[model samples]
Target: TQRYAITIKRSRSDINDEIKNMTLGCNRSGYYRNRLNLTENSRHRQTSSKLLNCLFKLFASRCNNTWSFEVRNSEHNYQPSKDMSVNRMAAAGSCPHQILSTIHLNDLSLMAISKTIYNELYSIRQERLDSRTPIQALLNELQGSDFEFEYQ
Candidate 1:
């Protein structure tokens, strides 16, 4: 029920196939259009190039050990939609990977969450007045992140 992780060292190398395979990135593509029509397999095939590039930058930044996330056995528990039944089915299964990992032992959650964040950040950067976390708005708060992180 649980998945495992692989570690990588960042000496500024190109991203390998398996790690690239693990990132979910469909909605960021042109076809998705905020629709839930595509199946999970189709989703994984087109990972977010933007986020992958972001990860590439992250990988190149520091000469230290970092997490290289991938998820296997995820077709059983990964659904990217607003459907409750699909999510219930997904929850019944075991998901052992971290958020940084491929949202499953696949890339569903990682891709979806990253896509959402990427969109939100895009809206913020564009100075959208209605954006929940606008850049100018964050400049006033100056607080911690909504998600928790450990200082390693």
Candidate 2:
């Protein structure tokens, strides 16, 4: 039940641009690469990146004590039944909120994989939002803290 926040060092504009370029690069690299479903709009890209960043930080922190973090993006098809029910209730003028399952960080390998996936998706989302020139290199920059979970 630990809470974590992701503080981006760069400005929002810069991060948005970076993510936009990364998304385009990913799309161009492979037509069927389904790692991220990025739109070609700056606004959508910005929102999606921000959302992903927040989720990643939250999951990473939770993973330190658990094994994984379950993502329940309303935009994605992974919403839990309770969430769907809550949305339905809200649409019917009720304020019911559905609870989804929590993802745990059970092992080092799972944590690493989760971190990698988060980083990749975050970069791609940011690039697509910024519309900046795309880079040709793989975006693999990871913080040293990413491995700290192994020791803990």
Candidate 3:
């Protein structure tokens, strides 16, 4: 029962080249903060975080048409959650054809595939956000214009 979250991602590629690297850490890898400020009063109840500051991590790299995985700080600070298993392959299997078409046949590692899919998805989301929201679109337009405004 191991679950990991991407802690870092790096990619360097031009139209003709691609390289990717990522670090995955135990899902519970951060300090749990019950409150942002002790003095703040909230109508909603404060929720507890599952973070245990776990140190376990896996580094995955793809370079020179090769893929490598390395582990560091290999101890988990908490017990694995029974119902928290994730099916990474299933998720990857559902990647849209547009994203799948950008991947090279040699770059078949789960990390590689996921990186490509996520990058495309992120760009699509950003484009949608920039284009669909009237306020955001207006602000972007204003930023490029000589128009001036004041706020308090």
Candidate 1 displacement at residue 149 in angstroms: 27
Q: State the weakest 10-residue window (summed lDDT) of model 1.
A: 51-60
**Residue lDDT tens for model 3, 7-117:** 653345545765566677766687856554653365265544556678888887887778899987788766543311123322455455434444434343323234535
The model with the greatest TM-score is 3
**Clash count list over all predictions:** 4, 16, 0
Clashing pairs in 3: none
C-alpha positional error of residue 96 in candidate 1 after TM-score superposition, expressed in Å:
17
Q: lDDT of all predictions, in order shown?
A: 0.36, 0.28, 0.57
Tell me the spans in candidate 1 whose CA falls farther than 4 Å from its real position: 1-100, 106-117, 120-129, 132-135, 142-152
What does candidate 1's lDDT look like per residue over 1-152, in tens digits? Answer: 23222233323334652232223322222232436677667775765332221111112122244555443222322233322122233245523223224333454444444444344345444554455556545654445556543432
Q: What TM-score does candidate 1 get on C-alpha atoms?
A: 0.18
Candidate achieving higher lDDT, 2 or 3: 3
